[model samples]
Target chain A: MATKKTIAIIGASGNMGSAIAKSLANAPYRILLFGKEEAKLKSLFKEIKNTNKKADAEIIGCAADASWEADIIIAAVPFAAEKDIAEKIRQVATGKIVISISNPLNETYTGLVTSSDTSSAEELQKLLPHSKVIKAFNTTFAGDFSQPVINGKTIDAFIAGNDEEALETVSDVVRSAGFNPIKAGALAVSRTLENMQSLLIQLSIKNNYNQVAGWKILHN
Target chain B: MATGILLFQSITVILYYNNMYEVLFENVSKKIGLTKEEEQLLQTFFIPKKLRKKQYLLQEGDVSKYLAFVEKGMLRSYTVDEKGIEHIAEFAFEGWWMGDQFSFLTGEPSKYNIDALEDSELLLLTKQAEDQMLEKIPKMERFFRLLLQNHLIAIQGRLASSLSNTAEEKYNQLVQACPTIPQRVPQHMLASYLGITPETLSRLRKNISLRK
Candidate 1:
C-alpha cells in the first residue's frame, strides 16, 4: 500500500532518519523529511541526493516542526522528544499513519530502565489517540539499514501496532525497503522489540564493536 | 477530647515510622523519597513472599498479578530464546522492583518470566491492591509516575552508555550503584544481566583488578 506513496519523516536530519532516507531512495516512494533545523534538513536532502542509487527517487526536505503536519510521520527523534513529537504529530496526521521508531534505552544502552508498562511506543499510543500509530524500523541498527542482509541473507524487520491496516501499510514499507516484515503483535509487543535493541547494543559494546558486524540476531 | 485524638493520630504515625527500617524500604524513601503517609500506606499493601531458586514469581502467558519489590536475594526476569536459553532481561536485589511491565500494566499474558535468582523475598502488591491503594491515596499515582520516570531515565542512560561507554565502564557504574550485588549473585547471572558472556565478565574483572 506504501507503493509510490508520499512519506514524511519527522526529526529527519539525524542519523537514523538519514539512514532511513537513504534506504528508501530506490523504493517506490517519495520521501519528505522534516527537521528542527531547516538549514540542516536542507543539507541532509542535498547529501541524500548526492548519493547514487538506482531507485533515483525524490527526497524533499520541509521546514515543518515535529509539532506539525504530514501523512506517515516517522518519528525517529531521540526518546526525550518522542512524546512531544507524538503530541505534535497527532495534531496534524488526522486519519494518517504515524510511524514511531523511537527506542527507549538505558544510559548504557545495554539494559532497560523502563518497567514493562513504560515504553515510548505505548506512551506515544496514549499520547496520539486519533492517529493510526504504528511501531516499526526501530530494531535495526543505524548502520544496518542500507545493508539489511547479514551473512549474505536478509534479516527480519519487526513491526507492531493496534491498527491492523496501518500495521500492514507499514509492513509494506518495510518490504519496499527490501527487508522481511515480521509482524510481532500489537503495539504492546513493540516493547519487546525495542528492548531487544538494548540487548543487542549491549552485546555490541561488550564485544568491542560498534557496527553491524558488532552483533547479529540470528532468527533461525 | 479533640486533643486526645490528635495524640492518638500522632502516635499511630510514630508507630508506622518505627517499623520502616528494613533493607528493601530503606533507599526507596531515599532513592525516590516516598512521603511518610505514602510509605505507611505502601507498607500496608506490600505482601511478603519468598521464592527458592528455579522457582518463578511469574511465568510466561500468565497474567502478572503483582508488582514485586525485592527485599533480599536476587531475582531474574527473562525470556527463553528459541534455542531455550534464557536471556536475562532484568535482575533485582535489595530495593529493586521487578515485574513484566507489559503484563503489569495491560493485564495481558507476559512473554517474560520473573524468577528468583536465589532464595529471595519480595514485598508485592496485587493489581487490585495497587488500584485500591491508588484510589485511597490519589497522590500515590505521582509516586508511581515518578518511579516510572526514574526507570525511563536509567534505561536511557544505559542506552547512551552502551553506545558511548565501554563494558568496563558499564560494569563500574553498576558496581557503584549496588556495591555488593556482584558478590551476592552468581557471576553468570550478573554477566547475563550485564549483557555480556560470563567469560567476558571474568576477563573484564581480571583486566580491571590487574590494572588496580
Candidate 2:
C-alpha cells in the first residue's frame, strides 16, 4: 500500500463526502472527517470504529468549515457553496492539493445552468489561484460511490487541473477507490468533461438506466 | 394588384429589423470577421424577427428551424418537466446565441421551451441557410464550427462549476459576469437557473445583503 497521505474531507457530513471517507477507510492512512455538524462527524467516525477493520490512519473528527485550509482537503460541498469553500480552502490550504468534487447542474439536475460559457472549476481556479485545485469524484453519485465496484470492468473517471502533480495525487485517490483516472489535458477541458457527465447521467436516467451501466472508459 | 404586392411584402418583412443588414454586418465584422461582400451576402440570406414578451421563439416538441442572433432585447431557453415546472436552461442577452442546439442539429423536436424575456429582435438563420452556407461560404464553415466549439466548451465548464461551486458562489459569479442578470430576470426564474428553490434564493440574497 502506498504510504497513506493524511487526507481530510471538508464536508464530511454530506452524502458524497461521507461516501469518500467510508470507501477509503481501509486504505492505510489517517482520515479526518471535518464538517460544520461536528456531532455528525463524530457519529460517523464512531461507526467506522465499530467496523473493527481498524481504520488504518488516525481517524479524527473536527468541525471546521470544509472550505477552510487544512492539509489535503477534499471539498464535497454542494454546488452553491463550492466557490466560497474554495476561497476559504485557499486561505489556509497552501502547497497542497485541494480536490473539488462538485457537479454544477441546474437546480433540477437537468442540465448545466452555469458553464455553457465557463465552468465552476475554472471559476474556482480563478478564486483560488494558488491552491492545486483538481476536479474529480464529482462525476459519480453517492449511491454508486459508496462502494467502488470490484467487478472486472474498471470505471472511467475524468481528472483535470493546472497542476500535473495535483492531478496525479487525485488519480491515486481514485485508484485507491478502485476506478481508473483519465488525464484529460489542462483545466480548460474540465468544462466539457465535468458538464458532460451531467448530460450523461440525465440521459442514462431518462433511458431507465444507471449511469454506472453506460459508464466505461476505453482502455485502448 | 399593386396594393396586394405591397401587403404581401409587408408580411414577409413584418417587424423585421429594417437595419438588419447594418446590425448583423457589424456583428459579423466583430465576431466572425466577415469581409464586406461576405457580410452583405450573409445579410441577404437572413431575416429579422421580433418576439413579443413571453412569446415562443421555439417550444417543446417543435423543430428548431432558426438560429437567431440577439440584435436587441433578452430571451431565455427553458424546459418544462412533466409536473409543468419551468426549468430555465439559459438566458440570452444582446449579442448572444439562443437555440435548442440538439433540435437545431438533429432536426428533432427540442425538449425545451425557448421564449423572449421581453419584446425582442433577432437576426434569424434557418437550417437551409446554414446548409447553403456550408456549401457556398466554405470559409464561413469555420465560424459556425468555432461557435459550436465555444458553446460546447461553455456548457462543459458549466457542468464542472455545477459540480464544484455553491449556489451563493455561483450566483455571485453570475452577478459579476452579467452584472445586470439578477435585476433583469425575475427572482424565481433566476433561482431556477441557479438550480435552487426560490426560497433558497431568497435566503441567499438575504445572506449576501447582510454581509454587505
lDDT of each: 0.71, 0.71
- Write candidate 2's Cα lDDT for A1-220 as tens digits: 1223557787887887887887777665456777767677777787777774688433334323222213367877876887666544443443456777777778776877674667777777777664677888766767656545636666677788887767887888888766778887687777887677787778877886554542576556
Residue-by-residue lDDT tens digits, candidate 1, A1-220 = 1113457777777888878877776676657777777777777677767775444333344323222223366877887787666544443444457788878786767666668876778887778665667888887777888788877878788888887767888998888776788888988898898888777777777886465732334656
- Native contact recovery (fnat) for each candidate is 0.00, 0.00
Candidate 2, B65-163: lDDT as tens digits: 678788778999888888989888899888788888788989887788788888776766777667876787677777777778988987986787789
Query: Model 1's A-chain: what TM-score?
Result: 0.85
lDDT of 1: 0.71
* Alpha-carbon deviation at A110 in model 2, angstroms: 1.8
What candidate 1 gets wrong by more than 4 Å, as runs, is A1-3, A52-69, A213-220, B1-212
User: Taking the tens digit of each residue's C-alpha lDDT, what string does model 1 give over B1-212?
Assistant: 99999899868755533442366557555556667777665555555444556666787878876787876778888888899987777778777788888788898888888777687666667676688778887766776887899889988987888788878898998899889877877888778767889999999999999999
TM values, all candidates: 0.47, 0.47
lDDT of 2 at A184: 76
Docking model 1 quality class: incorrect
